[model samples]
Target: MSTEPDDIVARITEIVAAELGVPAEGLAPETDLRGIEGADSVRLLRVVAKVEQVWDVELDDADVFGVSSVADLSAVVASALQVKA
Candidate 1:
């Protein structure tokens, strides 16, 4: 898989959209994830779970909590991918 940020953002956007029951096109890297209609902590965690499953990378609690948007999540994912690589 490509480790580029845009690719990571695209993948994260898809995961967030599915997990939050939102349209993929409506999501963007800068979108406030918590502002999403059903994006409570549990649902966000679920999104993180799906991301980890898809990318085969484990994210730390600090990293997870530090994310407020799809872009931040993409950064975390990219960092994890780098470490894994």
Candidate 2:
């Protein structure tokens, strides 16, 4: 898989949308995850879990906690993938 930043962001956007039961088209990299209509702690955690599964990388708890937007999550994922590589 391509570990390109743009590709990661696009994948993360889709994951976030699916986890939150929102339309993928409604989500952007800059979209605030917590501001989504159905975003709760549990659902957000599920998003994180899904991200980990898709990328085959474990994110730092600190990094996961600090993510506020899709782009932020993508950054964390990119970092994790880098460390894995």
Candidate 3:
């Protein structure tokens, strides 16, 4: 997979941190998104929506639902960016 830009990763991390109410530093690429303390389907989708706003990209629902970890979501965002580019 293509590596995402650092700025994109930072923005995504910020969105996740904000939506999930966790410190950005606590969100590693490998962190289990569903395992996070307050994460649920609705909250997760909200995070995805924030990412879409930040990156100006819409991700496939299939891809979003398939993501199990932050790395997976990052990859999906990176792919969406690539498509937009």
Reference-based lDDT, residue 8, model 2: 92
TM-score-wise, the better of 1 and 2 is 2
Report lDDT per candidate. 0.92, 0.92, 0.83
Instruction: Please give the lDDT score at residue 12 for candidate 1.
Output: 90
- Candidate 2: tens digits of C-alpha lDDT, residues 1-85: 6699999998888888888999999998889999999999999999999999988889999999999999999999998988998
Tens-digit lDDT string for candidate 3 (1-85): 2345666666677788889899999888778889998999899999988888777789999999999887788889888878888
Q: Candidate 1 versus the native: TM-score?
A: 0.94
Cα TM-score of candidate 2 = 0.96
State every prediction's TM-score relative to the real structure.
Answer: 0.94, 0.96, 0.87
Which stretch of 10 consecutive residues in model 3 shows the poorest summed lDDT? 1-10
Runs in model 3 with CA error above 4 Å?
Answer: 1-4
Q: Residue 66, candidate 3: how far off, in angstroms? A: 0.5
Model 2 weakest 10-residue run by lDDT: 10-19
